[model samples]
Target: MADSIAELIFIPAPGVGHIISTIEIAKLLVTRDHQLSITVLVINPPPTFGSGSAITTYIQSLANTTMDRISFIELPQDKTRQDSKAPMAAFTDFINSHCKHVRKIVADKMSQPDSGRVAGFVVDMFCTGMIDVANEFNVPTFVFFTSNAAFLGFKLYIQTLSDNKNQDVVELSNSDSTISVPSFVKPVPTKVFPTICQSQEGLEFVLGSARKLREAKAIIVNTFLELETHAIDSLSKESTIPMVYPVGPILNLEAGAGKASSDDDIIAWLDTQPPSSVVFLCFGSMGSFDEDQVKEIANGLERSGHRFLWSLRRPPSDQTSRAPSDYEDPETVLPEGFLERTAGIGKVTGWVPQVAVLAHVAVGGFVSHCGWNSLLESLWFGVPSAAWPIYAEQQINAFEMVVELGLAVEIKLDYKKDFFNPKADKVTAEEIESGVRRLMEDNKVRTEVKEMREKSRAAVLEGGSSYASVGRLILDVKRNIL
Candidate 1:
């Protein structure tokens, strides 16, 4: 008899962060069960923005190298709605527009005699609409949340509370008053809540996804059990949602492997520095600073009198653009003579291999934007962070890291307001300097982060929580197939 097969479908959103995380999960699933195969449905993003090229390249590389069991199918784009008012809106529109094509493709594949039997659909949290497609095909569906468990708990709790009064949570007052969330120890101050809670479109998007999650067979979060035990416990207790699976720290270490070849100059420079004496500053792909903020950061770095490696980029001309790719000359953005005076102690580049930098022994501090992926990488490497959130749900992540986890120092506790208001006051050089000093000087935060790093690494090892969670997920998929 022919070998039995278990195939799954993954529908990810149109950004680099989402695609990267989803791909990592797919790879992990296949590694854990050789009988399993993954068919990732890709959406053709507009030419101006999105991660189409990167995803295409990665899939092509996979086809030529390892992961032959994985395949990709790109959906045609709707040319009429290429332009959107915001990145979030654009992503939402793309998923809604292409979900029908995804369904058709999945159905066609299932009809083929030699094709593997479809067992499950793993949909990104942003692409939760695919759940309907899975239901139509009578396949079990799982929502892959590409964030921490605490954030998931926050979203579900807010949705439940808001439904009680038939009122939208985003429309609530943004005062300094605090509200209790299910899994958290202390009431979260309204000011540090997710920025989405302040916008109608964002709130609708989150609540809609949360509602969809309730119908899934299970929800897989990109976080481990030990990291957020309370949050995972809270989710597990809720009868409304599906089973919660904590299988994470799913990271792409390949980018770090070729660091010496791809970033020889930077690595060489770092080698000359003293042990644990350099600070590394890197925001996510979408992270950048205005001219004023750039100057302040330059001044702050110079004044801090520490060896530094800063990944600098100019802010996008369009605020709603997906990610910043334009590289600006350091002299153009930094204060006059700032580069010359700090040449001996600092180096600024357009982009660097972040994982490699964080893993290096010479690096001791990370000044980050508090994006979940970056935060995970920093923790995995045992580097203390100076939290500086920019957009999306980053503000909430920063607050959690500083207050709940005690693993990081805070630069701006409530930066979402300033991020949305261009004319808002910029963070001063003194504040940046103080934050950097505190992160580099504080031993308590460093010790805590080191312990978390060990836990993170241990969670993915053979006998770890994440390892067992992956096994459970694979077993669940196989049982569903039968």
Candidate 2:
């Protein structure tokens, strides 16, 4: 059976982050099981979503693989997204559009005798709609969850929020009651609920996806069990949900595309700084702020009086929503003389490689938007973080970090848009300074992060938990094939 071959079809959503992690998961599976092969199906993203140069470069780099086990199929751009819909709708619609293409592709693979058994389908977090196509072929399906266990549990348990089915989620979010979910150890404050889920469309989309996940054989999460023991355990005991696999901290370390750092200047600057000296402030690829917020950040960093590496990006100019672009001149939004005063202690640049910067010996503290991948990278590199969630499920991840796990220091300030005060800075200089200071100076957080760092590396090793989890997943897929 070990010598018998089988193939897994991967369908990742068009976002760069989703594609990158899907590739990592594919790579990890094939590496662990000699009998396995992978075929990745990529959806062509809309033009307004950015050039997708990052995904292009990443796929190109993998051209040198030793064995020709992994393959890619770029699906045609048949899905014309409704720009006015929420992001969740766009993703679901785009992926749902590709169902016929995927069905045809899988049918072709199944017909080819040389391609091996069609073992299973691995769909992205938002791509669960593909499960029906897999069902049509009588193949099992697995959902690759890109976030932490906490976020997964939140999504799965979120069906209870249907009482607000007719109400706007934003109004529901404003309610005074705390949230008690089966998966979380503590009651989550309404303030930290994901901003997107506060909308009617977004809530419906999230709940819809969560319900669909129960149809899969299991969910492959990008986190180690040791890091999220309570959430993982809570999710595993759920009889209704499918099997839960914790096979992660799966990261793409290539420079530029994902959390990789490749800038020569950023590396050189870090090389000169002393070990455990610099504080890194990088929100995820999409994180950026208005001029008021940018100024507040500068003030806060300056007040911290620590050596800093800040990835400062400007919000898109066209007012069409997209990832933040690097400022041609960062000094434009910065206060007068702010750059001059902090020149000796700080280096500001556009989009520093996150994992690359986090791995630096000089980086000690991280003030982040608490994206799941970024949080995992921070743990893998042993740097403590202060959570400043901007949007998406980050607020939930932040709550789990600050309240449930104590793995990160909390940055008190909502990153949500204030319609009443559009230009107002959400966080004060003092609050930012406080979070960074605690992250850097607090021994407890540093100690716990360092221990988790050891556990994270060990989890991927030969006999570690993640390694075992992958082994179990391989066995399950093979059994499904037979």
Candidate 1: segments with Cα more than 4 A from true spot: 1-3, 47-66, 82-90, 171-173, 256-262, 417-424
Runs of candidate 2 exceeding 4 Å displacement: 51-67, 79-81, 84-87, 161-171, 257-262, 319-321, 417-425
State the lDDT of candidate 1 residue by residue for 1-482, as single tens digits: 23579999988876667787888999888877888999888765455554444434444444334356888776777777645466456667668888789888888998899988898999988888888889999999989999888888888877887776576576563666778787676677777777767777667777777888889999999998878888888888988878989987988765645633538888889999998899999987778887889999999989999889999976656633445654646688789998889989999987688888888899999999998888889999999999998877788788888988888998897876333344535899999999999999999999999999999999999999999999998889888666
Q: What is the Cα-based lDDT of residue 139 in candidate 1?
A: 95
Full-model lDDT for every candidate: 0.81, 0.81
lDDT of 1 at 316: 58
Candidate 1 is scored at a TM of 0.93
Q: Please tell me which predicted candidate would have the highest TM-score against the true structure.
A: 1
Q: Candidate 2's residue-wise lDDT over 1-482, tens digit each?
A: 55678889998877667877888888888888788999888776554655544444444444344445898877766635487865667667767988999989999998987778988999988889999999999999999999988888887767645643443455757675577877788987777777666666767787788889889999999999888888999988888879999998898876463443438778888999999999999988777888887888889889888889989988766634465778889999998899899988899899777767888899999998888988888999999889998777888888888778888998863565421223534698888888888888999989988999999999999999999999999999999666
Q: What TM-score would each prediction reach against the true structure?
A: 0.93, 0.92
Residue 456 in model 1: shift from native, Å? Answer: 0.7
CA error at residue 304 for candidate 1, angstroms: 1.4
